[model samples]
Target: MLKNLEYLKSGNEKQRRAFKVINQLNMMEDLKIYSPILCGTIPLSIDTASSDLDIIMEVHDFSGFGDKINFLYGPFPQFKLKRKIIRSKLIVKANFIYDNFEFELFGQAQPVTQQYAYLHMVIEKYLLDTNPSWRCEIIALKERGFKTEQAFCHMLELTGDPYEALINYGLRKQII
Candidate 1:
């Protein structure tokens, strides 16, 4: 399912660069790396020029990965990074910024197949195959300040946590 990611290597220069950086990160033998799941507007094909790169990593190890990554990328010629624990999940994440483009690493202590990132990818594939029109609505909703997952729920009039909203939507729509 993720093999289609190879096409992203042909995306614009920035996307290509992001892909390269992600590949480099994946090469770290010590890290329990999962396939880099691309999220945000890029995969939906609704991204604006300013959209940044968002990649999800589901892994089994993160004991000291944050500090290690910080040390390795601290001197990124173009990016400055900040690491923090997401308040809800308490998962450590590192956000990297360079001018208007950004790259984020979300470390999930779960199998990639069991991660929400996998579900989002599934939703994306389902929407792409069966409801491409939703992509436009997503872009419109995003223009109104909703994130991608939020836009998915808002477009379907579902509420609450975006993850739960996705499940509810899948159930209600009989698409799960």
Candidate 2:
């Protein structure tokens, strides 16, 4: 479910459940205008029980995107919406818990593929595929409180900021 997301239907239990929940809420179709893309730990198969479903979107109309998110998820458990500036871009984010899965809807004017979350997931997936033995070590690092990207950075011996380090490494290696 990293790119097209259809594979989620046949993936592991959590993945299948994620697909069902997304379909049940009509998330993809409803947010199709914004190019909603699933990007997060689950797709990388290293998700812990606490991992939330992260859906990134390309949104130029902040007002409309905020309204749509509010209308769609404001009633859900622990639903919250906010606008904030990240990386010098004002974006909208919504969070809610439903069916035992917490959902994070992140919208920005930039293309979803260019967003850090998506890029990180893609790079991590690539590393996982090419280095099978690192999976357990990465997960172990995460269990010790390192974030996903941080865990990857630690394995690579990247010393700078984990997020930036990951991107820089990926760009130099052409992984993303």
Candidate 2 ranges beyond 4 A from true positions: none
List TM-scores for all candidates, in order: 0.73, 0.97
Q: How many backbone clashes does candidate 1 have?
A: 0
lDDT tens digits, residues 40-123, model 2?
888877888789999999999999999999999999999999999998999899999999999999999998999999899889
**Against the correct fold, how does model 1 do in TM-score?**
0.73
lDDT of 1 by residue, 1-176 (tens): 35345666887666676567656655334343555466666655766566776666664556566666677555554544444555355465666664445766677766555567567656756776787787777777778787777877776677799977886666666665
| lDDT scores of the candidates, listed in order | 0.64, 0.92
- Weakest 10 consecutive residues, lDDT, candidate 1? 27-36
- Candidate 2 total steric clashes: 0
Model 2 global lDDT (CA atoms, 0 to 1)? 0.92
Best by lDDT: 2
Cα deviation of 106, candidate 1, in Å: 0.5
Our model 1 lands, by Cα RMSD against the true structure, at 3.6
